[model samples]
Target: MQLPILAYGHDILRKQCDEIDPSYPGLDKLIDNMWETMYGANGCGLAAPQVNVPVRLFVVDSKSTHDRMDEVIREDHFVREDTGIVETFINANILDESDDAWIDEEGCLSIPALTERVKRPWSITIEYFNRQFEKQTKTFYGTTARMIQHEYDHTEGVLYLDYLKPLTRKLLHGKLEKIAKGQIKAKYPMQFVK
Candidate 1:
């Protein structure tokens, strides 16, 4: 089932998410629903907070981005030789970040009609539990790493806009306000601030 993604200005989007163990109820179903919601929204990733759940869980499917490189212009510019990963991350933590960085335009399901150029490390090492509760630590590079960092920020109550310059953010203030006022329309179901 696809869930309604919480839009910008939702208080939950600013709160840190809590870690959940395997004992958490409906873990499997929630993960499934998140995937469905993400695909429906045409997003590469979706975090728990985006769905109004304050949990340290997110799903990233860089594979889809990789697959679209043929038709999408410059889509593979930052993607590495690796095909990319499609996996779940629960209670995830970024352990290390490479010195190299790259800039790219990023958009979020929660923040519709907006895309910002953001700079992020080219590679990262993260540790997290998979959906089956198995502990795993892996390093990712290129587009996949950027995708992970974006979703990881949601777990820490941070948004991509926060990385923008003050002037840029100020310029976008009105646009962000419009989204907060529920004046934005998205292809996917969204719950706005009310």
Candidate 2:
């Protein structure tokens, strides 16, 4: 099932998400729905808050991005050689971030049709539970890390727009307002706040 992604103005986007354990009701189903919803929206990542669920969970599939990378670049940067790996992160915490920062344009499912360049660490070490509730710690780099950081921010009640300069944000105010008002058309289904 594909869930309706909540738009930006929704309060749930700004609220910190709660952690869920294995016994949480419909854990498997909810994760499946999120994947369907995210892929439906052509998004590389999606957080629980984007679906109006205040839980520390997000799914990512960076295979397309990975496949497009130059072979040399791929071998040099990515920790995994496999392209199109789907990962589910639950109750994730960033244990460390590299001081090296890079700027990349990012888009969000909740803030449809808007993309912004934000600065973030090039690598991160995170600890989280998988879909099966097994604990794991892993470090990610390059594009994968960038995508993870974006979704991780969602679980922390932060948006990529928040990282923009005040002037940049002001410039986008009109478009954002339109999005909040449900005045813009989105390719995927969305639920705007009334």
Candidate 3:
């Protein structure tokens, strides 16, 4: 089933997510729904908060991103050899982030049409549980790392727009207001705060 994505201004989007254990009911089903919702929205990543669930879970399919690598490389100089990785992260924590920062324009399924250039570390070491609740610690770099970081932020009550410069944010105030008022249109189904 494809869950309705909660739009910006939803209270849940600003709340920190709770960690779920292996015994959590319907864990597999939720993950599957998230994947369906994400792919339905044509998003590369989706977090529980986006679905109005305050849980530390997210899904990422970098295949679409991989498919766009040629254009990305031409426009942003992003160089990476690995491609097409799909993974689920639960109860994730960033152990460390590289000092090297990169600026990339990012968009969120919850925020609809808004996109912003945010600066984030190029690499990160993270500890997380897989779908089976197995613990795994790994390092990710390039586009994959960027995608993970974005989704991780959602779990911590952070949005990509928060990283924009004050002036830029101010400039986008009108659009942001429209989004908050549920006046904007998104290709996918969304639930806005009343």
Identify the candidate with maximal TM-score: 1
lDDT of 1 by residue, 76-154 (tens): 4444466878999999999999999989889999999999999999899999999889999999888899999999999
- Candidate 3 on 1-194: residue-level lDDT in tens? 99999988888998999999999988889999999999999999999999988999999887677777677483343345556569999999999999999988899988888888889998889999998888999888777889999999999999988888899999999987788788998999899877
Q: All models: lDDT? A: 0.93, 0.90, 0.88
Considering only N, C-alpha and C atoms within 3 Å, which residue pairs clash in candidate 2? 63-84
Off by over 4 Å in 3: 71-81
- Tell me how far the alpha carbon of residue 46 in candidate 2 is from the true structure, in angstroms, after superposition: 0.5
Model 3: lDDT to the true structure = 0.88
RMSD of 1: 1.7
Pairs in steric clash, model 1: none
**Model 1, 13: alpha-carbon shift in Å?**
0.5
Highest lDDT among the candidates is held by which one?
1
CA RMSD of each candidate after superposition = 1.7, 1.9, 1.7
Q: What lDDT tens digits, residue by residue, belong to model 2 across residues 1-194?
A: 99999998999999999998889999899999999999899889999999989999999887877877798877654666446457999999999999998887798988988898889998999999998889999888878888888999999999999999999999999999899989986999999878
* Residue pairs with clashing backbones, model 3: none
